[model samples]
Target: MAAPDELFCWEGAWGLPSVSSDCLTVLAYAQFAGAPLKLRKISNPWRSPSGSLPALRTNQNETLSRPADIIIHLRKQKFNADYDLSAREGADSLAFISLLEERLKPALIYNSWVDSKNYVEVTRRWYAEHLPFPLNFLLPGRMQRQQLETLRLLRGEESLEGGEELEKELYREASDCMNLLSQRLGARKFFFRDSPSSLDAYVFAYLAPLLKAKLPNGKLQQHLKSLENLSSFCSNILLLYFPHDARESSGGQKSSSPPQPEGGDYDHVPNKRRKQLMSVLVALGAMLSYAVLTGILSIQHMQKEALEAPPPDRQTLDPLDEDEEGDG
Candidate 1:
């Protein structure tokens, strides 16, 4: 029997294992190692000892939090899965995974949270599904604010700014990163030749969400698609390891993607009507908020006008001053 009773993780998106790359990495590690385990979906990480999802709690009363740590633990203690990796390969995998975490993670946050439409329509709703009622109402906002603040600090900006220009820049950087990975992969099945090292799981965890998500700022996804070899690698791994999520392009599926859970289709996060309604609501709210901000400025301008004296005209000007102007 597998030691872990439940692998806690964020919920799936479009039938993928998880929307969270961290969760995906841990889960993929288990799957690739052929470890027996159960998945536990969650909306928030408040209950976790590490205060994060993707926690691995074992039946032996051991708890592991953070995907990287969980994967390492699995390899060393649970699966002994890295026997194929030589000292050199293991060192390379370690360095590559670190690079992926540092570069790709912020871009994921930027695309999902900084993009208004995606946050309102997709990310918010998806998160809301997992939390209790009142927390559901507030936590998403708090999380979004955190993401925005992080972006501002990253960009060295004083105020929140979200638009296509920012997305364009972020996605360009992301595209370059993907292109480099694609070149690294070339014609190989995984990062280190045919065998999937720990690096592949980490990469797939990050890429799967981007590839499957239908976010408003889909430039990230578009960049992934343009790298055909990278797309194939993800598809092949999804088919081999996460067959339930491989419905879209996998050949000869025994069945379609995991049947939509009770209550709604995950792709739309309930139904078409609700998603449309959310879209309209987001658009209206954005316009209203913009108007309010500008309206405050306009109101302040009018108040200034009311307080300040009018510009001096000929009636208010003295003859001496007029002569002074003429002389000058």
Candidate 2:
């Protein structure tokens, strides 16, 4: 278990999915306002079929096979039934995924090959200047080589002439997708609804990687910087979930007096850790009270019936119970 308010992972350099998932965890903590939850960031050596990275495990003895499984597990812990997704919200999440597949994926495919005269030149120049030497060497060259091999296999040398046309198609698709996203975000504090939703988390994750990419002449950088609200939202969530000590170390200042323990004896040191632990305990007590009041964690017979009901088949694991009957 993590100490209160201690973040298990670092942020900023992480990929889209990881960042978005972290944000979801932060949101869960914020909603509870309870004891800080442990964040176990695993760096799994295995890769998924989609070529994505796998999660690291916190407990050496325990395993969570997939991201969805992790989400379900989190849902079972101190779950707020009020946070359950409605039918419409579920459909919207699916729609967001579909849109990304239709738009972003095609653009990625096309951009790999022939560079776009319109956007490609600008992006290429940017990448050349800002991207790290290793990445620049790997990404563009690999993409171009794959494109050449694909062209050769599909159309022979004759089809090479139409590469520019394919590139143009890709640019069109990507631009269209970006425009749609911008329009959807117009005037609204969030993308999916009034408050941030699961869909928003996914969108933020996918876009964060693109936003973090080195841009030419800092054009893309400037664009992202201008989105103050979005940036603030991201930063606020980070700080809340990943609180850190900010006190400055005093190397120059001399100690006025020797540090003394209570009762004239070297004893317990009063420090931030002790203070944080107390705060966490208090928060936990408050949460238990609220849960009891709301019937969210009630022990009433009828409420127990609902809580004890077997989770739907979609969930492979059984809910943890106070007794052995709940164990899977």
Q: Could you tell me every candidate's TM-score relative to the true structure?
A: 0.70, 0.42
Off by over 4 Å in 2: 1-52, 56-62, 78-85, 106-164, 192-194, 216-328
lDDT for each candidate structure:
0.76, 0.45
lDDT for 19 (candidate 1): 79
| Tens digit per residue, CA lDDT, model 1, 42-100 | 76777654567878887876788867677767766658456688899889887877767
Off by over 4 Å in 1: 1-5, 44-50, 150-166, 248-328
- Model 2 CA lDDT for position 55: 32
Q: For each of the candidates, give the backbone clash count.
A: 0, 3
Q: lDDT by residue for model 2 over 168-243, one digit each (tens)? A: 6555665666556666567566655555555554445445544543333333334445666554444443334333
Query: Least lDDT summed over 10 consecutive residues: which range in candidate 1?
Result: 248-257
lDDT of candidate 1?
A: 0.76
